[model samples]
Target: MSTTRPQLPDDRPEQGGSGVDDGAGPAAAVGRRTRRLTLVGASGVVPMARDFAREALREWGWTPAEGADRKAAAEDVLLVVSELVTNACLHAEGPEEVLVSTDGKTLRIEVSDLGSGEPAPRTPHRAGRPGGHGMFIVQRLSIDWGVLRVPGVPGKRVWAEVAAPA
Candidate 1:
């Protein structure tokens, strides 16, 4: 008699650029947990990144509370995501991956790209300028942010963290 092979279930999660739910819930934990998104060839990558972030936050129960600011705290997160992704697309020739994570009251975002150049805000500020405000937006919105570059590596990761709504 012949033996049959056992069936295995697929545990991989769905990837989407839209805010629509694909049945993947937010990650659960008391400490830091990371979710990575591969960005190569992703259409409408900026909004997609924002949607991905919003979904993760919803899973963590980070929605805006009653009597809070009219601009939902999630909007700030979306702005940060847009700015970081814009910078990656502009300066770094687009991002290779995007990492979203939360640690208690702080949400962290990291955009990894292939460019070797460091990122910096325009000197002396330029609010009146027609463009060049991406990093500046990042500087103002984030509670804290910086770049991480491994020695001898040809790429860099720009990260920012914002406080969650109460």
Candidate 2:
């Protein structure tokens, strides 16, 4: 739920489709795919969330069977998912939901929580630090990531994107 980059993605939908599946706009698959899981009040949320994301990746053809590179890519996505969910659990009371979406070229992972505190990477990162590496890891693994306030809502959504393997 934290990031050093904090680079905001374009505020527009992808292509001619909404490319979002949380009911934020008109529904349109159009070759895009999404999977969502509610973690609110759930026990053992971190591993549960990671498993959920792994299934989505495999279902979307990102797996060892795809090739070695694809397998590594899938692992990276799983790590990002774990870090974000864990951050929410630690900093935001707990995560409310996890939404994973792919548009053929990139995978987006979102973690939503009710906490109002903003997530920012610990600046001047120290290599020997013992903790607080979550956001730093996220920033390194992701192509772009940032926090978005949910309009008319009390919570915010932290999102990260990973490029598909070539």
* Candidate 2 clashing pairs, residues 3+ apart or interchain: none
What is the alpha-carbon lDDT for the whole of candidate 1? 0.70
Q: What lDDT tens digits, residue by residue, belong to model 1 across residues 27-144?
A: 4333455566778877888988888887777766675445555246677778888998989898888987777777667777878788876777787787998778887888887887
TM-score of each: 0.77, 0.83
Tell me, by TM-score, which candidate is best: 2
Cα lDDT for residue 30, candidate 2: 51
**Segments of candidate 2 deviating more than 4 angstroms:** 1-28
Model 1 quality (TM-score): 0.77
Q: Looking at candidate 2, what is the lDDT of residue 101?
A: 82
* Tens-place lDDT digits, model 2, residues 28-112: 3355577778887789999999988888887788875577888778999999999999999999999988888888799989888
**For model 2, what is the alpha-carbon lDDT of residue 116?**
85
